[model samples]
Target: MLPHCIGVYACGMGGAGMALATDATKIASNPALGGRLGNELSVSLGWMHPDRTMDAQGPTPPGFPFPFANTASGEQTSQIENYPDGALAFNYRLSPTLAVGAAMVPGGGGETKYAMSRTATGQMGFGNAGAMYDSQVRIRYASLTPTVAWTPSAKASYGASVILGYMDFKSNMAVMNPAFTGLPSSPTLMTSGANELERVYGIGLKVGGVWDLSPQVSVAATASTGTRYQRLDDYRDLFTGPLHLPPNFGVGVTFRASPSTDIVADVQYQMWEAVEAIGGEQPAQGGFGWENQPIFALGVQHRLSDRFAVRAGWNYGPSPIPDDVVFANALFPAVIEHHFTAGATYAISDRWEVSGSAYFAPKVTQTDPGTGDMFSQFGGGTVITMKQYGGQVGLRWKF
Candidate 1:
């Protein structure tokens, strides 16, 4: 579900822009549009206010086999005060129908820190999430991309980009002291020294094309190859060899409803089931168990005058994490499914422009069924709720 999460115009369009022709600033969406851009550059800043809450409620089964407390209730929440995802982009035309561009932008990332655990349960069980005491995980990702687009005819254009990606991670989690799990004698049953650090270097690519079917209708598609991140050689104990950014593809259409209004719709699919660190089979034992996700978005733009315009959009996607893996996803919850956005653009002069947007994702909550292996594996019924508020502003110029 992490498909191009930040862009000023795309954010106002519910993140749907595979077919919409935009100015030079909309770098995060379809790169194929570079060929149609004005010879200009822009810088943008975005803010995300994400609120994540985890709650546990359930009963310990009769033969649970642990001498911990009978039943438990716990809650943990996270708010990222300084989570800023920003970008810089420039586009220049080499010929009437050929253009090139470059951008530095946020890839995808998450971070959370908390210190709370159960009294007797320790931290290593499938129930360990209930004991999220002394737990922390962080990811920082960015990409530098150089892109080129070719317009063969006035109605068709093709584009591609080279993605230079970088990511770093650090994690510290608590686990049940091996001694408490029938290994040997120890005074404290909960041990909290499992620390892991890693960084990755990777490269990937994106290719796309737009076809204008008529004077008022157009279609576009984009495909992104997966980026295989190098293993955390320093923390082999925590991760296996390959961690990857799964491949994704998107298609969209733009309809010129009126001389002054436009409509856009797009669909995107993420191959989450293809990644190991993110998607695997045995979450009960240790798989991430994330499912493939498809996202849909629709937007409309209306021009009130020559120098003023407004936009509104809506977006939706299914949850990637099944309740089965809710226990394992406490650190990186990507459960949001709905977004509503609004934006405006103003031209101050023939060459100066300003733009801004706001979006909100209402609370979405998932509760695990505490029965059979689900209950025994999770050991506690886990409920997770996630919500977000975001805003972006930018300045642009024309040559």
Candidate 2:
């Protein structure tokens, strides 16, 4: 899945401000913050570049006659390198303690494209050999949320939003045709084939609350149900059921360390294990065998002057895919575990400001034990390594 910090201010703080109202972007992290932002609009654009490589080695699986003479031992780079991200948000006050807002936020998805298919059945083996059918998969998601925030009392606020989500999915898998293995034909093991991308939509709900314990401290919590998407009938063979996003929840605390400085900490959980399409064991359900994931983030922001401020933070989340399923998850490796971020904002005038943020994630590598299972996607003994860098810039106007 994509990183959670897609907004300019959120990215700057390593996604830690669930209890503070920064701007219209607050609609994303915690709709309850909408009532805190008077009147504002925010627009942002970002660039993300991730470098990934796959290394495969083999003593081929038992009884596997076709050893892929050309692809048996080699390293290949993923063709999918760059991605564009952006967000838009607007909030308007409806009453002394009521607010209404809307936002276009980034949901999470993953994509990968490999030049040479991993299957051993190339031209030299069985199937026609031209460019060695490419194996690729792409999935994307975005949500439009209409929210309402209510502050019935001085110390607490509540909010809710209707999550209208859209998704596009595509997959082109290359596998050994079971027809050649004296077994019944299986769509999951068929030769490479092209399939049109499918567009699907779904809806979910999100609700949150914020409470002020004291003048200098605040706490907040938010939760959302899974968005159940329409089934991708076109590639039913590659997936056991519709691809629905997993449910998630988060809690955060904001501490006003001093008048000029603030510290924020957040903890989040993703219930991937509850979603059949994402958490089920591989081969049996065509799933990635992902476990539940927990993420922790910490950020600090200090005002340097009346018109300038700077922030930095750290974010960490362990990979959800277990070592036993590495081969099955090669195409969608979500192994990034640590992120370092920094950003600054400058006021152009009383009504407008510009902000920019950048992040760096050091490289991480994972290799699967060579079990050599015939049903595994990449065959065992596959090593995947990845690292990423990205930045976002934005303009905010307070009227």
Candidate 3:
């Protein structure tokens, strides 16, 4: 699942939120912090819940033999009742500047469902079969990373980390009402599953320096680059075609505004263009390649006292899916252009802390040309629209 692989907190923090990850317990930023372990071991646990809603524009006119044209107004929407996921991580310090760690996190997946009773007329045939259908795609990956950091001097620090992991993908699609009679009782559908437990690896190098411009002020900057994932073939079933994990890089800065507050900002770019659909690779099913997108984030954190703290942040990005490629799968649908989020954290004791956060994505609209603005040729003409929201809570314990 994209949520699991990207880190549950990633939903709200974005790529730049790493500045707040000062300890080994938070998984949002660089894992090298895990190497800062003193003489004790550390562990962290996190959980997330997501809610979503979608509203779509009715299909275009011109009665044709397609799915969209079969309805009074080929438009459909839905609200997901519940969506939940989580993660866990552990780290051990072998020396003052070296640490090893392992973590289990949810990646990302897609889901969409629609139900309606209606009829329409189009060029291909009378539209009534594809009127109702439910489809979904779920993909997930778990990773383990070990890191080493060298704080050779008080002014600068550097490190390297490696990631190894496994991936799984499953897809289910069904056309609730097939047009013809005497056909299979179940809705027309296609399903596929694949599990690839391969040795995937990534290396990251980070360097940062602190300049004490004055006693009460300081400035710092860090930059890193490495492959996030080499190939996504192991989870081919999750996509309409083959895809590859692209390289990523980020640069960020932190400024101390006051004795107990700080502001952080970062801009990261992922070479999403390197990713191509599985179908695109084959000679026949011409691919609808996705374009690269840039993600921007900004956050602020305040220390309330010796053991209490709070933070808030925001992020935005362009949709990864193209408008022309509309796959009616339950796992994912309605990819949009932006996301919004907010969150906070509190310390329960000297050794434990808890945090909570939420995310919201606005609704998006699109039209399928082949389906003729409103219907599915297989069943009834079913029009679809979608949106999403998510929340998370986590616990951190430091030894």
Candidate 4:
């Protein structure tokens, strides 16, 4: 899902903490920025709500073996899903010119549970477009980074982090169609036996920098190298290949608009097209047919008093899943495109603070007319849609 979420500060800013290093999130957003903050630690928990559904193609082969058209109009939803995306970070400044930082947190993930599906299957060679089936996919990724930042001048700084990534992916789908391709010889796709897929540890690196243009303005940039994930041993018959997390780059700027207000803006690019398993043009032959995605975000923070502060932000991006690939990607739909966010921070004391944020993205629906080679044989005119909203709360200690 690449929520692009990390610590509370980053989340409150709509993923715009790279240049505004005010909290512990600096350890994850820009290692170099961390040293500027004294020793600090934070923990956060989050929740998600999604209303999604998938419908069968409008046109199907006459006498299709399944009853997809009949049940395609229903809404399938998971009103709430609570996930743990907590972070703990520490920063140390060895000298006026050198600093170090470290953090552990969730990097990316998504979950989908589809209880509403058109599964009207018949005894045949394979399940028709309309078959009774239940399916779900949940992917989780975590990362630990230790960073070092060097400041050679009062106005410029640079840093790098060693990234250690851990990821787990699971998928389950079953169709009552007697014509299931995995019927007798390869029934693993239909049940729990060999359906689970996992990728243990993947490693990578990140580097970033911030430059002071003036007393109240700064520019920042960060880049991450891609991670090559291990293949799925249990589902070798399904993927037949390996999948990888793509690299990404971002640039941002921050301005101290007033004595109590700061404004931040950012542009980011994810090189998803570099990954073959899911970055191609189609989902068949074990590909997810995904495309590269770009993100734009902005945030404004204002201090009402020494003890109270509030912030709001906007994050936007194109859907990674295209309409042509909506069918196969139904289980992994990360298509929501527009998000509005708001939050506030309360200072419990000089050394303790509480931060919270909330965001909502309107639903995005992709419809595939089904002109590809596979659609003609299987089905056509399918539709997939996803809408999401979430919130988080964090407690921080700064020394």
lDDT of each: 0.71, 0.78, 0.45, 0.71
- Whichever of 1 and 3 has more TM-score, that candidate is 1
Candidate 1 residue lDDT tens string, 1-399: 363345677777787777886666454467788877879877778888888876644554344554332224367776453588667888999998889998887777777764443322544333344433334567777888889989889899889888888888776643334344442332132223244556788888888898999999999999988666777665443443455777888899999999999999999888887887677554444346778888899998899999999989999998898876665565677899999999888999988778888899999988756442442254346677888888889877788
TM-scores of all predicted structures: 0.88, 0.92, 0.67, 0.87
lDDT of 3 by residue, 162-251 (tens): 545454444333222334352233223232231223333333343333333454444444444432554445434334443334445555
lDDT of 4 by residue, 1-399 (tens): 777557777777777757877776676777768645666777777776776776655454454543333244454554335565667777777888888878887777777766654222311212323333335677787888988888888888888998888888775543322234532332112423123666678788889889999989999999988666777665454453555678898999999999999999989898887887677645555566778999998889999999999988888899987777666676677888988888899999999999998888898988766765453224356677888788889888886
In lDDT terms, how accurate is model 2? 0.78
Deviation of model 1 at 391, angstroms: 0.3
Best by lDDT: 2
Report the number of the highest-TM-score candidate: 2
How many angstroms is residue 165 displaced in model 2 relative to the true structure, after the best TM-score fit?
Answer: 0.9
- Cα misplacement distance, residue 125 of candidate 2 (Å): 8.4
List the lowest-lDDT window of 10 residues for candidate 1.
183-192
The CA lDDT at 164 in model 1 is 85
Of models 3 and 4, which has the larger TM-score? 4
Q: Which candidate, 1 or 2, has the higher lDDT?
A: 2
Q: Write the per-residue lDDT of candidate 2 for residues 90-191, one digit (tens) a residue.
A: 999999799999999888776788766655553223344344442567899998989999998888999998889899987665553545653222223432
Candidate 1 ranges beyond 4 A from true positions: 1-4, 25-27, 57-73, 79-81, 118-134, 174-197, 371-376
